[model samples]
Every structure is written in C-alpha cells, then in structure tokens.
Target: MKNPTNGSLAQTFQTLEEYNPALNAGVEKVALVLQTMALFFLIVLFIIELQNYAKKLNSDDGGLTMEIVTSIGMRYLVAFLMVMASGEILDFIMWLAIQASKWVSSVLPEGTYNMTVPGIKGKVGFFEKPIVFLFSAIAQLAVWTNSYIATIIIFLRAIQLFIFKALAPIFVVFVMSEELKSIGIGFLKQFSAYALQGVVLVLLMGIYPALMQNDFLAGDVATGMDAWLTNIGVFFLIFLKALVVLVLIIGSQNLAKRLIGGG
Candidate 1:
C-alpha cells in the first residue's frame, strides 16, 4: 500500500481529516449494525426512565411532575437525533480540529522536512574508514526507518479515529444516563486526543526545519577526508533529530490529552 503520510505536511493533514475507514463496504455495514443496535438500546433506556418516573409519580412526595416528564422526553429526543447524526458530528469535530491545527501551523515559518535519506556525494572507502562508513549506513537506514514508521503511525491513528466514530453512537447512549455520563465523557476525551494530535505533529513539522539549520554547519567548509567525515556526522545528527521527532509524534496524543485536561 502507498504510504498515506508520504506527502506535504498540509496534504498529510488533509488525508487525516478526510480519512473514514467506514468507506469500506464491510466496515460500513458493521457501523450501520452498531448504530441500529444503539438506537434499540436507547429506546429501551428511555422506556426504563419512564417506568422509574411513573413510580415516582405514584409516591406521596409528588416530586416528579409533567414538566419533568416532558423534559425527560425531550432529552431522549435530542439524544436520539444526535445518535442518528453521529457520523456527521464526528466529521465536523475532526474537521474543526484539523483546521485549527492548520491555522496554528500557518503562523510558523513555512518549510518541509525531507524524510528520505540524505544523499552522500562520494563513495565511502569502506576499508580505510570502516567505522565512518558503518555510521553513515546506519544514519541512512535510520532516516528510511523513521519515514516508514511515521507513515504507519499516521495510518494507525486514522484507524483509531474510525473505531471511535463507529462507537460514537453507543457512547451517545451512555451520555443519556447520569450514571454512565462519565463513560461517555471518557470516550469523548480520548476521541478529542486523537483528533487534536495533528496539532502537535503540525507544530513539530513547522519547527523542524528551523531546528536543523545549525550556524556551525551553515558556515563550515571542509575538504578531503574532513569533508567526508563531516557529511557522516551531519547525517548522524539528522538521524538523531529525526528520531526525537518520531518520539514526539508518537506521544502527540498524550500531549493533546494533557492540553485538554483529560488526564
């Protein structure tokens, strides 16, 4: 499969915003089934609420009244409508989050990271400087590996968002009950974390180019063996920086959660 993240930073964000695993026919069918089941459960819960209210009506306290009954009915009606439109609601949330991140990224200097292995100008004399050659090879491999892993992480995050979308209807039902509201709130927090993760990733992308521009490297001029050694060292440093970027990207969801006070 083509790497979805193999694109400009803006394109990557667009891909994430547009991702919908339920576009697959099988997944669509499963989501529909889940939605239908949720609707059924919602109806059952509403009936149970009415029964409990009726019991309260029969009590001497007379705490429950017709207005409260109407309020309960209206609450379920709204929940039912929200469950029916859950997909649209999720899409809107994702779009809003991605757009917010994009706006934030726009304020930063514009640049892109080339995740591909940096090309070496001359062939390495493997017999003479074996350790340099080995380090050079390792750095190139690390760059390629980082690119591959970043693509996989983006793809997996899309899948996670899809799973959250599929379960949204069920969670909407949870929100209808005071006893289960926390469960529903937890689901929303996690969904928000994944949704807002792009913010951190975009910010990192915006900052990476500036981070890589070293004054010492910018002014340096080397010749002969020194030049070759310098290139190896520079590539190794890039690999190290790329490794740190990958770590930050992987932890982005947690960072998002913390930002939203989900922790």
Candidate 2:
C-alpha cells in the first residue's frame, strides 16, 4: 500500500515527512476558528454578565459579586483554552502514532508480519515488529493523548470546582429561603465535586504507569507470562487509578469546602 501523506520519506527526513502538512494546517485552522468564536462569546457574555453584576452588586449591600465573577470567568477561560489545546494535541498524536508503529515494525522485525496502516501496506520483519507496534500504539494513544486528556480533565474539574465555589453562597440562601425540601441544587453542588475529581485523577494517574509496563517496554516473546502480565497490568492499573480518583473526589470536595468555601 502507498503512504497516506507521503511515501517512504524513510530514507531522508524520516520523522519530518510523517507529519502531514495539509492536515496540520487544517486542524490549526479549525482550532483557530473555534478559539475565536469561543473568545467572542466569552467576551460578549462577560460584558452582559458584568452589567448585570454592576446593578446587583451595589443593591445587595455592595457584596463581592464583581470579584467572584471575574475570578470564575478567568478560570473558565483558561479551562476552555486548555480543552482546545488538548484537542489539537490529540490529533497530532493520532497521526504520528500511525507512522511510528510502521517504523518500529520495519526496524526490528526481520520480515515477520505485515502492517497496512493508513491504507498503506508494508512488511515488518519479526526482529522488532511486535515491540514496534506495541511501542507505537502505546506512545501515540496511551501517552500523547493520555497526558493532554489528563490535563483537560484536571482543568475541567477545576472549572466545576470554580462554578460550585461561585454557587455555594447562593445555594445557602436558596436553602434557607426556598425550604430545605427544595434544596436540590444544594445537594447537587455537594455531590458533584466528588464525582468530577475521581474521573480526572484516574485518567491522568493510571495511564502512564500502565504504559511504562507495556510489552513494547522490552523483549520479544509476546507469549505466556509476558502477554498475560501486560494485559492484566493494564486492567489493574486503570482500576487502581479509578479508585484513587474516587478517593480524590470525596476527599477533594471536603478539602475544597474548607479551603475555597465551595460546595
């Protein structure tokens, strides 16, 4: 099969050619448009909210509405940018991963197996093919995307934390004024922090550790114990990570309540 972007730049500038210029440009364009649109709405929303805040702030004993909104908005903006960057980074990882797998297969394998990736078919020797494939897959999906995803998750959790912090004051009043029976929002804010924190921690903490033990890490013999260990290790790693995350959710919410005074 022929290379999807460019064929066999392998002999010259091997790594360079693997990057698809056309796709990169396209991805960049889309990201730019999204950022621009998001910023536009953010600014417009900020202006409107600010105006509303101005009117209410002085009327309500001139409280800290302006400060709270400004701070939360800044956090929201940062979280949004991080999310977009995470997306672009994921695209790069996906493309490079396809190429890396092929390269490894070619290097180690003395012509053991064939890999037809991105619609391009090629023969990979047994010498290093398995490791190559494992490495490529692990690095591309499990590492590159994993890290950014973790960051995204963290920032997302932060965003939720910020929102809850912003709302805690309002909810207290709502509980008092609207009857305890109608305090659904209060309960939601209390519980939401726990749920969000666990998710972020699991994605970030467990991913790389699992990747480190990958079959790609060393040796051939993808048979017997090696293969079983790799598969089982991955499962347990993720499970443990998830457990850590759960601890964080419940724990962090309590911490946040004490430190940041949020639900």
Candidate 3:
C-alpha cells in the first residue's frame, strides 16, 4: 500500500511538471496577443491625431503659415510642460485650498456657541419647547448638509486628480491636434474650475467663522414663539446661500468652457 501511494504521488508530481510549460506557453500567447492589440489601437490613435494636425495646417489661415505654425508649436510646448508638471501644479493648487481651510478651521470653534432662546426663559408655553427643539433639529440638519457637500467636493477632486494628472500624457496628445486641441484645452479649463471651487468653499467657510459668533438658528427662547420663527427664517436664507454655492460648483466647468472659448 505504501509503494502504491508513493507511486501515485510521483505520478502526480510528474503530471504537474509536464503541464507547467504548456500553461506558461498559453499565458504568454495571450499576453502577446493582448499587447499586439493594444499597440494596434495606439497606432490608430496616433494616425488620427496626425491627420488632425495635417487638416489644421491645410486650413485657410489668411496665408499666415509661420504665425499659425508658431502658435501651434507654442500651444504644444505649453501642453508638454503641463503634462510634465501635472502632479506638481495640481498639488500646489490643492495646497492653497488646504491652507485656506486650515485658517477657517482655526476660526470655526471660536465662532460656534450654544443655541439659546432668551424668550422662553421665564414662562415656557406648551408648544414653545417643541418649537425650540424643532429649530435645533433644523440647525443640526444644516450642519449635516454642509458636511455632505464637503464630502462630495472631496470625492470629485479625487476623481479629477486621477483623470487629469494620472492620464496627462494621453490628454497632452489631444492638445497637439487642432481638431482635438479644443477638447484638450476645454478639459483642462474645466478641471481648473473644478479645483478652484475648493477656494470658494474655503472662503464661504471663512465668512461664517469671521462674521457669525453663533448658530444662525439659535435665538432667545425668552422671546417666545417669535424666537424659533426668526431662526427658521435665518436658516432658510442660509440654506439658499448653500444652494447657490452648490449651483456655482456644479456649473463651474461650463463657465470655464466659455472662458476658454470651448463653445
């Protein structure tokens, strides 16, 4: 029985040894085919990009050959520089926002204070307590909304970093072709606008810290029902401001596209 077991083990090892080369060969073949396909695709893209260059050169340019060539060259040069310095340039832009945010953070704790309704101090009516609580809940909701917006902005910035900086070389190729250069320039402008939102958000955060000493929803409970009512009104106005900020952030890319002459 031991001899049979040993023979079986040997057979298994031998079979595995025999299969290794075939498995490796199959993997290598697949890799080679995939690499070839990728090469073919890149070549196609290169051809298309070159064709765009040719089309632009042949376009009616009021016989300004040297000027057009020089302009295109300058643009490509700038694009090359951006590609090489993509990480550094973007990091610097982000650093500015970080610094601004830090300044805002230093001011935030000092600005916040406990919610108080001076109107409800002496005689608390039946609905007065509930109204105060309601206003408090609304204040908490506003804070939560701001947090949510900040999180979304951060997530979008991460995506932009990955797409613009990581794949900058690919985008740079687009910049060399007149037909595609607009797309490239437009993309860059849009990304810049997106990044600039961080500054705007920081400024908004700074405003409250500098101007507001306490929650806008906080009011004198002793002032009776009018206190919470005033807080709700203030909350709505602040919420409107938040909505405006969101709209600006979302439409920033379009604004950039126009500024860059994208359309």
Per-residue lDDT of model 2, residues 109-148, tens digit only: 2312211111101334455455545544443443334344
Model 2: residue 105 alpha-carbon error in angstroms: 37
**Best-first order by lDDT:** 1, 3, 2
The segments of candidate 2 whose C-alpha lies over 4 angstroms from its true place after superposition are 1-139, 177-263
Q: What is the lDDT of every predicted structure here? A: 0.68, 0.40, 0.47
lDDT of 2 at 83: 36
What is the lDDT for 117 in model 1?
48
Report the lDDT tens digits of candidate 1 across residue range 73-126. Answer: 898888888788876777777887877776776576544453344445454455
By TM-score, the candidates rank as 1, 3, 2
Q: Give all TM-scores, in the order shown.
A: 0.78, 0.30, 0.52
Locate the minimum summed-lDDT window of 10 residues in model 1: 1-10
Q: Per-residue lDDT tens digits of candidate 3, residues 1-263?
A: 01111121112112111324564345434433444443443345555645566676568453435565576567656655555554455456555545544454355443331212212233445665576556545645654465455556545654554455444444544555556667666666665655554445444443532333343424443455465556555555544555555565455445544654554
Model 1: which residue pairs collide? Answer: none
- TM-score, candidate number 1: 0.78
Question: What lDDT score is found at residue 91 in candidate 2?
Answer: 34
Error of 1 at 208 (Å): 2.6
Query: Which candidate do you rate higher for TM-score, 1 or 2?
Result: 1
| Deviating ranges (above 4 Å) for candidate 1 | 1-5, 8-11, 15-28, 50-60, 115-130, 215-218, 222-233
